[model samples]
Target: MDTANTMIRYVSPINPASFPSLSILLLAIGIFFMSWFIVYEVTSNRFTRNLKKELLVSFFASLFLGFGVLFLVLWVGLYV
Candidate 1:
């Protein structure tokens, strides 16, 4: 038997509560950007689209939103 050669490792889990401020900030920024994006889309002319502006806005909105939601879930102890 080679049981003596076996090794065990322990890893500490992340605690979202450690950075509540960061989570809140991200959520707020995400919502703000998303709202503006919606308004822009609704009011802007389809035929006169500005691809650069739209892409930039949408990218930031999605990025912040994804991270914000993820952090929020983790903060609430939903380890999904």
Candidate 2:
């Protein structure tokens, strides 16, 4: 008879308590950028659109917002 042997590994999750400042910073920056993007969209003239600038702003806004929310969710002890 032969027996199989297997090894188990343990992985640790990120601890939000370790970097609370980072979480707050990301959230703030995300909110600021999102607000700026919204304002720009509302005030800019459709006929004189700057695709490059608009794209850049929107990209940063979404990127930061996404990360920010993710961090916040993790920080709140809600693992998903």
Candidate 3:
């Protein structure tokens, strides 16, 4: 019995089959809607020279921010 080989065998904490598919979907949708709504509301009152460009930027910014936060939380969760 090789101790090195035995210790190197991998085990995953996350199993896809056990994950809640609906929650993932809801999370994605919620993020999209929340981001969109906030962007729309913020920009709706202001007169933008390029409305389309403004909205697009806002959407992506919010999306990346949300994903960044989610990633950090998930990373922490895995360790703690």
Lowest summed lDDT window (length 10), candidate 2: 1-10
lDDT of each: 0.81, 0.77, 0.58
Q: Estimated TM-score per prediction?
A: 0.71, 0.71, 0.38
lDDT of 3 by residue, 4-49 (tens): 8668666656653433453355456657766766766776666544
Which regions of candidate 3 deviate over 4 angstroms?
A: 1-48, 78-80
* Candidate 2 segments whose C-alpha is farther than 4 A from its true place: 1-15
Number of clashing residue pairs in every model? Answer: 0, 0, 0
**Candidate order by lDDT, highest to lowest?**
1, 2, 3
TM-score of 3: 0.38
* Model 2 lDDT at residue 67: 79
Model 2 residue 61 lDDT score: 80
**Could you tell me how far off, in angstroms, the CA of residue 72 lies in candidate 3 after the best superposition?**
0.5
Report the Cα lDDT for residue 4, model 1.
Answer: 58
